[model samples]
Target: MTTPRYKRILLKLSGEALMGDQGFGISPSMIKYVAREIRSITDIGCEVAVVVGGGNIFRGIAASSYNMDRASADHMGMLATVINSLALQDALEHSGVQTRVQTAISMHEVAEPYILRRAVRHLEKGRVVIFAAGTGNPYFTTDTAAVLRAQEIHAEMLMKATKVDGLYDSDPAINENAAFIKHISYMSVLERQLKVMDMTAISLAMDNDLPLVVFNLSDEGSMLRVVCGESVGSRIDNVTDGKNRVDRTAAVSESYH
Candidate 1:
């Protein structure tokens, strides 16, 4: 058997990815597909922990921008994440993967309260852990929660699943001249104002020297490829090893696929 690159990893999935082609709400088929991909890695002895977002059902920031109280909106967003977490848990169990949902908020009826030791225990027992509720606080993105949980669990790296293949100098969908960055420094990401993640999350990961791999979740087997150390996404860390960014027009197909 080929050895995997990272024995354990934290995957950050935006709530939007759960929507599939739908404009809003979770898609059952989509959740099942994600569960299968996750199970595939676990079958190879790779431990997985996931932190999911809640933008599909509710986005606190967007609601607050419309005049709702920011804190209340964010709390509502947190509930949305809990919903996604439960759905994912059910799907994983159906796929025969042992799973646990630990939430920041105290919800004994649904999930266990977030406990660092227990969460680690679940992973050690070969069960996937799904972290929900976004730190159980307002004004924080799921990105930040993912980083925090990853550090607490001592995950080898954080995998940020997104709609795009990887980070680019510009929005690839809008800019034909965008550049594909295969490897980048965390400082460079913040300096360039890349939208890979929120500044707080990026800074937190940078301070702790946690490497992040941003890749497209829609592509089949993309997650497996990333865990295998294939060059499928833009990797951000403290060092670049003297690699130059490639123009998207020249390397988009080769690098992303």
Candidate 2:
């Protein structure tokens, strides 16, 4: 048995992750696999909340290149997030994991509206809350929404699931020799211009003294390892205006296999 580092955590999954190896659209197999991984965490008694992105279907900022209205495009992207949320909800329930989808915009027909206090109660009862629709506002990315929800829920940490295993000084796939950061300081990440999250999201996390851990969700058990007191990838914490900061390398172990 192992003690957990964070009792409750907000896991942010990009819509692209749901796409998996299919290259486009939701990959049924991949969603189930990911849901199983999430189930493993809940089985261990850690409350988990997920904030999903809509980039897989559409991206508001990307459409700005064309004649699309920025606000309208962003709203469309938000709707895309709801689609992903329902997909995840179905997959998770099929895996026998209790799940809930809450949107920033009130769409009671599809899912519950985002109510911070209510979401916290859901967690207390061991339900996984999926926050979709990206803050129900334009110009705010899902990354920022994750930060906001993590704060409102008083989450112990934020787990950002990315294509890469952790944060790197440069692009990992393009740069084979790029160094992977097992841990980094929040201020340093901002000062040195590391691409973890957007400035707004980073600022919120910094102000709240919330540690954000980056890891590869493609790998099995990575999320579990982080919550159960295992350092998987780069942990960004400690800011000049916030709490103390430190960095260290984490060896691969059961912290998550």
Candidate 3:
């Protein structure tokens, strides 16, 4: 049996990751795949919490670019996140994983309001808690919401699930010679503006001393390997600020293969 490095973690999943090749709304197969991966870790006695984004359904910042009121756009984005959260909860339950959906904004009909004690209690009872609605406010990204919830729940670390394998010096999609980074420091991430996560999210994680792992979600068993402390992706921590960062050799690969 493989022991996990962190007993409890907050897994951040982007809504876009749920879209599959359709490039639009939710893909049932993709969501089920994600649910099964999450269950793999939970079955091994790991406490998991999730914070899902709303980009696939709606993007507040993108709407604001078209002169829409920022607040209204953001609110709509929050509702979109709720839709994804419910879908995720259903998938996890079907996979035999006990799950709960809690929203920052009160949506009593579907999910319980986000309460710190109740959320923690759910994790203690081996139930995965899905946090939706993004802080119950506008103009904040789900990335920030994930950090906040992780801190509130005292999660050991935050796992960011992306299509890419790990952080890179450049956008791997455009640059063929982009370098993959194996390890980085929080301060370095902010100073270099690596964009693995939003600045607000990075700063919060830095201040809280919470380590973050970024890895490819589409790859089979990647999440389980990460939880088990395998070197499957980039790890960002408080190591020496900027003196020692591991840079993988430049390689060419499709963004999602």
Which of the numbered candidates is closest to the native, going by highest lDDT?
Answer: 3
Best by TM-score: 3
For all predicted structures, in order, the TM-scores are 0.95, 0.91, 0.96
lDDT of each: 0.89, 0.85, 0.92
lDDT of 1 at 154: 98
lDDT tens readout by residue for model 1, 1-257 = 65678999999998988988788999888999999989888888889999999999999999999999999999999999999999999999999999999999999999999999999999999999999999998988999999999999999999999887788887766666678788888888888888889999999999999999998887889888888888888889888575546545532432221
Total clashing pairs for each candidate: 0, 1, 0
Candidate 1, position 49, lDDT: 97
Model 3, C-alpha of 169: deviation from truth (Å): 0.8
Any idea what lDDT model 2 has?
0.85
Rank by TM-score (best first): 3, 1, 2
Residues 1-257 of candidate 2 have per-residue lDDT tens digits of 55667899999988888887776779999889888989888888899999989888999999977989999999999999999999999988998888999999999999999888899999999999999999999999999999999999999999999877788766655555566676677777787777778888988898889999999887788888888877687788883455433333332321111
Per-residue accuracy of model 3 over 1-257 as CA lDDT, tens digit each: 77888899999999999998877999999999999999999999999999999999999999999999999999999999999999999999999999999999998999999999999999999999999999999978999999999999999989999888889877777888788888889888898888788899999999999999999898899999999988888898898755656676765464532
